[model samples]
Target chain A: MIQVENLTKKFGNVAAVDGVSFNVENREIVGFLGPNGAGKTTTMRVLTSYLAPTSGRAAVAGFDVVRNSLEARKRIGYLPESVPFYPEMRVREYLSFRAKLKAVPRKQRKQRLDEVMERCRVKDVEHKIIGHLSKGYRQRLGLAEAIIHNPPILILDEPTIGLDPAQIRQTRELIKELGQDKTVILSTHILPEVEMLCNRVIIIHQGKIAIMDTLNNLVKDQKIKLEITGNINDITETLKQLPGIKNISFTQQDLWYVVTIELSNNEDIRDIVYQKIVQNQWGIREFKTERTTLEEMFIRITTRE
Target chain B: MRNIWVLTKKELAIYFYSPLAYVIITAFLLLSGYFFYQFVAGIADATALRYVLEFIGFISLIISPMITMRLLAEEKKSGTLELLMTAPITETQVVVSKYISSLLFFIALIMPTVAYVILLIFWGKPDLGAIICGYLGLICLAGVFLSIGLFVSSFTSNQIVAVIITFVILLIGWVIGWAGEFFREQWWKDIFKYIGFFEHFDAFRKGLIDSRDFLYCFSLIIFFLFLTVRIVESRRWK
Candidate 1:
């Protein structure tokens, strides 16, 4: 339940978030994928009303971020990239204070606090001073604070950053669980995390939305790889002549030829290439169609910078 | 109002949990007590209540910055300002809470000095009117210093820089009255004397509740608090 229309944030001469527009539907888990300084955090901050956009409008739950910031903030939970906390406060105390700041009713605060602590798996360290906890525990405490009010919208910037593998897995599972009923906009540089957790992905590069689509659609529409061991030069030219073939390159390793073909669109050109190979009487060691991974797509998009 | 109280409570809790608050109060109390004892013994007078009040005013010159140097600076350094600002609380709530908590701690530290007032009651009859006025003056002075310190703290993330800048500003405001005496022009002298902090405080110490003096201190406090809020708001852009 978030809408950003041409949102832009500028720091003097540099545009941190430039003319970016996107919508996150209710109960949808959308991943904001980008490299460092790709304006992901800036965009998230604008949506959360932490930083005022130099131009354009953003709204959460039908409230304009600038005009109705307090009401909008009341309906959304934000976990910044650093997840700053008062180190001296105990985990439960911090979460309770955050609950009060979020304007949870006095009567419901304790129950909401306990529920979020349990959901975030931070109940055990509830009494421990947040400063004394390890990084993973501190991150969980941050998450606990964000969800204490049970806000419908969650804007988490790099939610799984700096966690160990097990902690990452745990957090990923928790995010998936939370996404069941909450609208989550997760910004991170981790491509696989998006593929594993988000239903839709928005890849941002150089402060612009490069690609935004479902994982299945993004992979199905981009480049495809075919490994064929045959007359390398002849088959490469023939594959290039195929209707859907956009670009083809071949690298030889030992006795086999690995050919990577970029397609103009998602189409079945495998049979046509196979017939061409047979007509040319090329030696075929292996022939299989390969779809582009999200990682490959991300690298292609970001590296274009 | 609820948000303000919550933030105020959290700020005070932070002061108590950290060792810095204890260290600041202890150092201030010991130094002021030593100055009070010496000023009493040196003057060869039993009534040192006014002298004690003046000494406290000077002690606030140091203690005020110590209490407020880290107010917004540390929040910015630690990145916690993002958490506070992104919450439902408004910027005014944040500024007012921090200012109120600083004043509360300042009052708490000065509360123990009531023993001195009790001692005066036992040893000699200090003018009750002047004693009340003296305390009023100290509180107002602390308010002014705290506002300036909070403003300075909001300008930088460096606590040391905040402290130094606050101290310099307070020192200048404290001593600027002397500049009028150095000048030969009577109009310039009068203007400097009227603008100085000590001039406004002198009326309060004399058992005179002048509205102009009260308005001056109140305006200074409000002005600095407003600047602190504006500076904090501008940081989000940076």
Candidate 2:
């Protein structure tokens, strides 16, 4: 439902979002993963039509963001990074106002207000002043405000930033439910959040997209770890001769030797390695294949040149 | 149009929700009330609300800034401008809604002073035509001042700065007509006389519904509102 091509947004001489392009299909949950000042917020701002791109173009739901900003914005429900609000307003009042601003039909306004308040778990605080609410409630109130109008596309900047662990889990579950039908592009610093919530992950660094791939494909690379009480040289030499063995490193942990093996491909060579170890008559202590987590991959991608 | 109403309603609610509106309104009423009493008791021919209206107009010079300072400045300061701008509304709608809300609050601020007119009618013969014209003039003058204040508030995130700058600008607009007397040249005189707010307002005080006065105030209102819209739109580009 969203398409961007070579989009570059520069603030004065500094480029906040530089030459990035991605498309999100309907009913897809795309997580924007990046560290601070990595252009995640900036990209979302451009998509929401809050900031005009310095160069290139972006369109939302078939409307150009700059030229048809009103139409494009109409389809997007954005929760800005800081979750700003008029503190004097009651939670219910604020949501009602936002619903009106988003052009929610008069007939459904009350129902929608209640629905979002319940879904975001801010129903108890609906009558309370926003300024008096705690950070977690305020964050949920922001989420309620975003979805009050039932927009098809949601661009949330760190939606679960301030919530507690249980609240975070609840919000993750809520987002997962919403992503079943809506196109969601949420930026967050939590790696597990992305792994659990996103179908595809886009890692942006230095205002450019570092890597974009499905969650499964990105974490498909595996590593083998083994602990064997045997001659380190002989074990290394035997492992090197096996096909699909990219590289191997060994570290001594007291009497146990910890060997980490990098596989050349997404291949299971455990049986071959087992036979080789048996042939060598090495005492096997531990053996397992570890699928690389998004955290490790994210650090490797972002920190690498 | 519905969006404008929605925003205006929210803006007005914000005014009532904060202490700023009550404080300014109460202060204005107390000050205006004291002056109204002084004008009525001190002058024998207190048959007209002319002086009182003028006093209210002058009081608005100070009160308009307070009314408008937070209209846009607070939104920018609190980051709610992002929510408003990202909504399906144009900058013009946002500016117009803010202007309308402040104007409504300004009207509410002056609504209590109508008792002075009633007092005059009960005690003496008062020209209702002139009185009506005076109120019309006040509304138009308020339109001009509040628009200027909204325009000033648009660019700044600091409420105090917005109020001070708006007051300064309105003061200049108010005093420029007096400067016209110092200009001996007819061209310079007309320019100052045309731009100054005092001249336009004086005509309404004298019960003359001259189109020139209405045009000048309305044009100023439209000009400032247009400028505010441009500033709001420029935010995206910035």
Candidate 3:
């Protein structure tokens, strides 16, 4: 339920979120993948109504981010990068304060607070001062505050940034559960977190949307690695003759041939390669096809600088 | 209005839970009380409560900065301003809530000084109207100083910087009248004296409820608060 139209944010001469646009459907989890200073946080801030766009428009839950920021904010929960909190407040008190700030009705604030506390799995530390809690608990508390009002849309900037392995897994599970019912836009540097939690991925680099699509399509489109052993010279020629081959290269050893190919469409080429090897009567020691992971894809897109 | 109340309540809770509030109030009371006691001892008359009120006006200069230095600066330093700004609340509500809550704490700290009023009642029979008017003036004075402090705090994340800037602004506002001495023109001297905070305090101490003086305090409060709102809103654009 979020639509961003040519959103751009400029801090002086720097365009933090350069002309970017995307849409998120109801109950869909969209992962924002980018490297440091890639404008991920800037875009999140624009969507959450925390910062005004230097140009263009955005709407959350059908409310314009500029003209109707208060209404837009009411329908979304945002956990900023780093999750800063009042250190002296107890966990429960802090959530209660955030509940009121979010305008959760007075009659339902306490119940809402309790529900979020449970949802974030922070019920046990309700009374402990937030400053005394560990980093994981603090992150959970930040999440709890974001959802305390039960907004339909969640914009989390790095929800699992500094957590340990266990905490990351727990947070991933919690985000998965959240995505089942609410529209979530998660911005993070961790590729696997995006892979496991998001159905769609939007990769941004240098303040532009480099790629945005379903994970399956992204992998199927860009992932191609060929390992084949045959008459090296003739095999290279045959592979280059293939219709959809993008690039061909071999290691210096020259004993094995590695060809990098980008398919024009989703087509199976394994059978064709097998037939070519048989015709040549060359021993095929290894023949495998592997797709690129999100990590590799991210590196490829961001490192193109 | 509801959001303002919620924020005010949260701010008040913070004031009580943190040591800063207690320390400021205790120090204020002890210092004001000592001065009040000494004034009575030297004058050997309880009627000198007016002098005590005048002196506490100066005490407000110090305590106002202490109460307000952390209002917005601490939020920026800790990054909680992002949370508050992202919530469904307007900038005016945030500024007003913070201003009122700090003023309330200042009032509460000064409330204990009512015992001093009772002391005057039993000993020297101070003018009840003048005493009441003086307390009203002190509250308004605190309101003006707190607004200045809040506005200054919004400019920087460093609490020390906020406090130092606030003190300097308050000192300028306090001493603008003296600068009139250098000018030979009556109009310039009159202008400086009119802008002085102490000039307004003098009207309240005389037990006269002038709307002009009330407007002066109200306009100063609104002006600084509006400046605070602009500063906060400008950050989002940046």
Docking class of 2: high
DockQ of each: 0.66, 0.91, 0.80
Candidates 1 and 2 compared: the better one by lDDT is 2
For model 3, residues B17-102, the per-residue Cα lDDT tens digits are 89988888888889999998898888866458778888899889987988999999999999999999999999899999999999
Evaluated on chain B only, what is the TM-score of candidate 3?
0.97
lDDT of 1 by residue, B1-238 (tens): 9888999999999999999999988888898888777876677464467787888888898889989999999999999999999998889999999999999999999998888778767877778888899899989989999999999999899999999999999999999988999889999998998778998787777778898888989999999999999999886666
lDDT, model 3, position A117: 88
Candidate topping lDDT:
2
lDDT of 3 at B114: 97
Best by DockQ: 2
lDDT of 2: 0.92
Q: Per-residue lDDT of A1-305 in model 2, one digit per residue for the tens?
A: 99999999999999988999999999899999988999998898899888899999999999999999999999998999999999999999999999988999999999999889889989998899999999999999998988888889999999999999999999999999999989999999999999999999999999999999999899888899999888999999989988888889999988779999999787889999999889889998899999989999889988887
Q: What is the lDDT of residue B197 in candidate 3?
A: 92
Per-residue lDDT of B1-238 in model 2, one digit per residue for the tens?
A: 9889999999999999989888998899899899988888887474447888888899999999999999999999999999988999999999999999999999998999888888888888788999899999999999999999999999999999999999999999999988978878999989998999998898898789999999999888999999999998898888
**Which of the predicted structures, 1 or 3, would earn the higher TM-score when compared with the native?**
3
The residue pairs in collision within model 3 are none
Each model's lDDT comes to: 0.88, 0.92, 0.88
**Candidate 2 displacement at residue A96 in angstroms:** 0.7
- Better model by TM-score, 1 or 2? 2
DockQ of 1: 0.66
How does the DockQ of candidate 3 come out? 0.80
